[model samples]
Target: MLTDPSPTRIDEATIRALPKAEVHVHLEGTFALADILFLAKENGEYLPGPAATLFDITTHDAFAAPAVSTGGGAGAGAAGLSGFLRFLDWQCGLVRTPAQAARVAYAFAARQSASGVRYSDVIVNPTHWNAWRGREIALMRALSAGFDEAEQDGLCAVGIAYSLLRSQSAASAVDAVATLASARPGHVVAISVDGDEKVTGRTGEKFHEAFRLARATGFRRTVHAGESSGPDGVWDALDLLFAERIDHGVRAVEDPALLARLAADGISLGVCPRSNLTLGIYRSWDEHPLPRLLAAGVEVTLNTDDPAPLGSCLEADWAVTAEQFGFDEATMIGFAARSIEASFADDDRKAALRSELAAVVDERSRTGALSS
Candidate 1:
C-alpha cells in the first residue's frame, strides 16, 4: 500500500495531505521572523539581523554551541544558540510576561496547522524564564495556557517537553529538571536534553551527570547527539542518558553494527532532513541518510527541526523526503506509525493516532485517489 515517491511516482500534493506527527521540533528553533520582530519591538530589544538574515548558516558546524540562559531580556548574542537563537533573542524581549509566551505558543500551533502537522510536542527551556521571573514555574504556566488555547482553536493536542542546554551547570540542569518534574501531569509531557552535542560527546562528564539525574527523577528522555559529532555520541546518549530516542541519529547510518543495534533495541530516530542538510550532514535532500536508515529497519520519523529558520514545514519535510528519496506510500505510512509509537503520548493516545493514520491510508487506497 506504500507508494514510494519518485520523479515518475506520486506527486507532491499527495505527500502534503498525508497525516503525520512532527516529533523533533524545538520551540526556540521555529520562532517565525515576523514574531521575532514584533516581540523585539514590544520589549525594546535590539534584534541581531533583518528577518531575512535569520537562516544564514554558511557552513554545517556553525550551529554547534549550547544555549546560554540569559534573563528574559535580550543577551549579547542573538537568540544565543544557533541562528534559531538569533530569532529567539528578538522574541525574548517581548516574552517577559505569560501573555507573550501564550501568544507565541498559539502562533506556533496555528502555523503548524497550515503545514498539515496533526500533532507536535515542542521543547521549551524554563531556565531563561526563571532567570527573569526568579521563578521557573512561569514558563510552565505560560506554555500550559498556550497549549490550552491551541486546543480550543481546533488544533490537535500540542504537548510540551521541558529542556535545558548543556551549557548550564550540573546544579542548574538539576534545578531545571526539578522544575519540570513539579510541573508535570496537568501540563508538560516530560523533560529532555538539547544543546551542544559535545556536552554529551564521548567524554563530557557534566552532561553525563545531568542526564542521569533527569532519568532518575522519572522523566522521559531524549538528547541531541551524532548531529555534529559521530556514532559514539549516539552510543553515549543511549548508555548514559537512557534516551528513549535520539534527536538526529543519522550518523548511526555510518556504523552498520550500531544501526542493527538501534533496530534491535527499537529505538527511534527523530530525523530532520532540512536540518541535516543545513547543518551539512548531507549534501542535499536526495543524498540524505534517511533512505539508508529506512532500509536498515531503524524506526525513523520525519520532522522540521526548526521550520522558520530552515524554511521547512512539516508537510514540506515529508514531501521532500518522499520525493527526493523515493519513499513509497507504504514506507511513508510505516514512518507515521513509527512516529506515533515512539511518541511520548501514552498508550491510549498512541492507539487513537495510529488508528487514525491507518484509516486515512486505507481510505486513500479505497478511493483509488493515490497517485502512483
Candidate 2:
C-alpha cells in the first residue's frame, strides 16, 4: 500500500506536535497580508493593492507596470519571485514605528507558539526603521517588551539578534553594534550581516572589522553567506567575518573541505527548508542538502526564515524535513539536540533545554507518538 518504503513518513499530526527551536526567523519576515494591511492602515501608508489582492500581486513582474491594473502579479493560487519582492517592498510600509514593531514581534511569537516552537531567536533589522525615524532606542525597548510579553504568555522564550544590513557602511554597522552593546537590551544575542548576499560577498572585508569588535565585546556573530554564491562567500564569512553561525549554508555541502571545516569549527547553520524551496534554492525538498549536512555531522537547525510570506510554519518545516529528507524519529530528536547544542543560550539553559527535550521525546515514545 505504501508508495515507497521509507523510514520516515512524516504524517501531518506527528510533525505538528514536534518540539523544536526556530533559530533563523526574521521579525519583519513574519508579516502576513492581513497584518500588513492593518499596519499600513494604521500608519497611513497606501498599499499597492487591496488586502485581498496583495498575494496576487506578489507574482507580478519585477519590471511590471505599477498601478496599471487592479489584478496584479500572479493570482492567489500561485506566487512568483516578483510577488515576493513586492511583499518585501510592502514590508517596508508596516515597520515604521516602535509600537508596530512590538506588536509584530508579539504576534510573531504567538504564531510560533501556535506552530509548536519551543524557543526562537528572532532577527530584527533596525536599519530600515532608523532610515524612517532614527529611533533605534525606542525600537529596542519595544522589542524587549515584546520578548517579555511572549515569555509571560508561555509561548516560548524569545531572544533578539540584530541583523545589520550589509548594504550599510561599515561605520554604520559599528554604530549599530555599539548601540546594541551599550543599550538596555545589552544581552543582544548576536550580530548578523544580512541583505543581498551578493553585496556581502563584495564588502565582507569592510564589515569584518566591525564583526571582530562585536565578537570582542562578547556579541555572537553570524553572516548570510554561501546561500547566494560559491564557497568563497562561506570562506569570507568564516575567515573574514569570523561568523559564529552561518545562515543558509546549503552550499557548504558542495565542498567537502568546507563541510569538514564547518564540522570541526562547530559553527551552526540556520537551515530553512521551505524558504529554500520558495526561493528556488532547491528544485525540491528531497534535493535539499539538509540530510547530507546532518549525515556529515554538520551542526544544523531547522527554521522558517519567513513564516507568513513563505506560507511556512514551524510544524510545516518539521513535517517536510522529516517526510522529504528521510528523517526518522531518532533523526528528528538528534536534530533538536543539535539545535540546543548550537544555541546561543548559556550552558545551564542549554542543559535544561536538552533535558526537557529528552523528556518530551521519552513521553512521545511511551505514547507511541514517535516510530522508528
Candidate 3:
C-alpha cells in the first residue's frame, strides 16, 4: 500500500539497497576525472579544466554543496552549456580505440553498482564522440562488448540508446535510423533524441519519419525534453516521436494538460534532480516540481544524468530527493519499481529485476533495515 501524502523519513542506505534501473544516463558523460586524467595523459589529449579542480566535482560533499560557478550560478540557466558540452567532447575523444571504449562501458557498470543500479538504458550520442565520426558502428560494438562482459560478470546490465542530436539535420536522422536498422545492433535497444532542445527549437516534425522507422525496426523510443526546453518539446516527443519514456520531464509540470496526459498514459519521467539543479532548471530541490508531479500521478523515477561529471550517483540522487522532498519509504520504493519498468531492457530481465526488487525491499522492511 502507498503511504500518506505527507512525506515520511527514509534512509539512504535503504534506498541504495533497493534494486533499480537507470533510464536516462548518458554514456558520453560517464567518465570519472581520474579516468579522464589517466586517459588524457595516455592519449595526449587536451583537458579543459585544471586538473586540481576537475576531480572536485566527483566528491559527494562537493556535490551537495553550492553549485560550481563556472560562469553559471545555480540560477544561470544554460549559461555555461558550451563549456559543459566541450568537456563531454574531450572525454569522448579519449577513447582512442575499441578497447578503451569497452573500458568506458565496463567502468560505467562498476560505478553504477555503487548506487545499486542493476541495469541501465544508457544514451550514447555520436555527436560528442568526434573520434568515431564514420565508425559509430564500431564504437557501438565496442560499448556493447564491454556491457556484455559486465553483464556476464554480474555487473549492471546496459542497453544502448542510439541517439539523434537535435542539432543534426532531419536527413541525417533518417539515415542514422536506416543505418542502425540495417546493422541490427543486438545491444542497441532504443532510438532517442538529445542535445540542447532550447538551441534546436522544435525539430520533432523533422524527425518524425526517423522515429517511425525506429518503431518499425523494433527500437524503443525515448527523448530528452522538458529540461532545457519547455513542455512543448515533451509534447512533440509524445505526439511526434511517440517516445515511451521522457528524460528530465520536470518542466511538464508547467502544463496541467500535459501532466494529465503523461499520468494517464503511464509514461515515466526519468527526473535527475542534481542535473536539473546543476543546469539551473530549478533553483533548488524545494523549487523543483517533482512533488507536484507526483501529486498529479506522474510516474517519476530518479536518475544521475551525468553522474561522474556532475558529482552525481543514483544513490545520492534518490536519497537527496527523498530527504529534501519528504518522500516516504513507499514512494521511494515506487521510484525503483517505476525505473525498472521504464527501462528498455528485455521482458525477462525486467521481470527478474522486478522480483529481485520486491524481495529486497520486502526483506529490508521485515529486517528493520528500512523503517516505515
Off by over 4 Å in 1: 1-5, 8-12, 46-87, 127-133, 198-200, 203-205
What is the alpha-carbon lDDT for the whole of candidate 2? 0.71
Expressed as tens digits, the lDDT of each residue in 112-171 for candidate 3 is: 877788999999998788889988888899899999899899899989999998888889
Candidates' lDDT values, in order? Answer: 0.68, 0.71, 0.81
> Candidate 1's residue-wise lDDT over 40-110, tens digit each?
77777764444465455322233324444221111112233443443344345457777888888888888
**lDDT for each residue of candidate 2 in 1-372, tens digit (9 for 90 to 100):** 112335657665665465667778777677777788887788787766555655555434442333321111111224443344455655655677667766777887788778766677777777545434467767777777777787788876677788887668989888877877777473368888776564334667989888988888888877877665667778888998889888888888999999999999998898887777666666676677877887798899887777775566777777767776556777777777877676676777778787888788889889887787
Q: Each prediction's TM-score against the native?
A: 0.85, 0.87, 0.91
- The residue ranges of model 3 lying beyond 4 angstroms of the native Cα positions read 1-9, 55-79
Worst 10 residues of 2 by lDDT: 68-77
Cα RMSD of all models vs. native, in order, equals: 5.2, 4.6, 4.7
List the candidates ranked by lDDT, beginning with the highest.
3, 2, 1
* Candidate 2 deviant stretches above 4 angstroms: 1-8, 56-86, 130-132, 184-187
Among these predicted structures, which one has the highest TM-score? 3
